[model samples]
Target: MLSQPNYREIKSSYLITKEAIELAKLQDIDTKKYKELLKSALEQVLDALGISFDEIRGIKKMDAFF
Candidate 1:
């Protein structure tokens, strides 16, 4: 089970990722390239979190984490 602080940390990390992507877009990053980069990075994070894409939909509380 994740502690409250750990949950918050993950949320914050995701927020930063979102912001970075937005900033890249604002600076004219290509959507196709960005998505490719994001997919790779997200895969790594999901693996580190022990959260598989298949399990995401099964865990209601974790649905928004991805």
Candidate 2:
């Protein structure tokens, strides 16, 4: 589902995933804030990447992270 191009499906999946994580938090299954942040960030990245192909035009020069 993460690799899917359909925007509504992507959003639905994202919401479902986010809800599950939030429920887990309430249950004390995984309480680390950083873990939730990381998960949310990855979901955002997946959604952004899924939508970006249409707007992309050219290559981006790569640089090493410091």
Candidate 3:
């Protein structure tokens, strides 16, 4: 199991990625490929940590609404 500190770190990273994606969109940058790659990486990390997508707040499922 992941420690609380580690979980927080992962969560922070997830949020940062979300922010980056938003920023990229605002700049009219084509983030399709990058988004897919980041999403995949996030999922993998969450799985490894045994954390569900629902475990994180302030973000939608797989950023579908983004």
Estimate TM-scores for all models: 0.34, 0.25, 0.34
Which digits, one per residue and each the tens of the lDDT, describe model 1 over residues 14-50?
A: 3333445435555565779977787777778899998
Better of 1 and 3 by lDDT: 1
Stretches of candidate 1 off by over 4 Å are 1-29, 53-66
Q: Residue 41 lDDT in model 1?
A: 77
lDDT of 2: 0.52
Deviation in angstroms for 10 in model 3? 47
Cα deviation of 49, candidate 2, in Å = 3.1
TM-score of candidate 1 against the unseen true structure? 0.34
Q: Where does model 3 exceed 4 Å of error?
A: 1-28, 54-66
**Would you list the rank order by TM-score, best first?**
3, 1, 2
Q: Is candidate 1 or candidate 2 better by TM-score?
A: 1
**Winner on lDDT (1 vs 2):** 1
Per-residue lDDT for 31 in model 3? 74
